[model samples]
Target: MADTSPSEAGNAPLDQMGLDNFAPYLMNRIMGRYNAALSAEMAALGLTTPQMRSLAVLSVTDGILIRELAVYAVVQQSTLSRALDALVRDGLVRRETDATDSRATRVYLT
Candidate 1:
């Protein structure tokens, strides 16, 4: 195989950006385009990116609490609640209390 020449390697600052850089940048570019399309397709279904994320998390995990959703959604509790509210209003999700811990509320995809 041909070797990587000195300058064949990217500039130092770019290399310093490294794998961490590529993953988010590339993922964001792809997701941005995909989200644009998804937004239009799912608009009639009343779903937004945040709402879809919440539903996916609840569906996969199957009964995580609101606090856990906040973590999974990578947002503040208030933000997750607002997202969940829209989803619940749209009939895509339901929240139930944990009998063992009245303070805990688990969310599930309806």
Candidate 2:
């Protein structure tokens, strides 16, 4: 008989552990493959996933606040700041302080 134990099957069946049987483990492998292809394509464009996402968000919202852009870009605030700074230096993006709130910065595409 074929062994069904973890040592032989690699991972225990979710049903055995009483967890949801959605087969998330296999889905993770599929996602990894997809990400690898996506990263390669983005790299050819001189952009990382985060940078690409930022550009996509900017295209949709021509002038969005920096904080809101960060959320849409799906990057950490500090990481987004560095990415935005690079985009600004490259003449692809610019920042402007809100007239009503000097502390807040709005980002615009160039």
- Per-prediction TM-score, please? 0.67, 0.71
**What lDDT score goes with residue 89 in model 2?**
87
Give the 10-residue window scoring lowest on summed lDDT in candidate 2: 13-22
Off by over 4 Å in 1: 1-11, 15-23
Runs in model 2 lying further than 4 Å from the true structure: 1-31
- Please give, for residues 28-64, the per-residue lDDT of candidate 2 as tens digits: 7787898789889989987777777888999999788
Using lDDT, give the best candidate's number. Answer: 2
**Which candidate has the top score in TM-score?**
2
Clashing pairs in 1: none
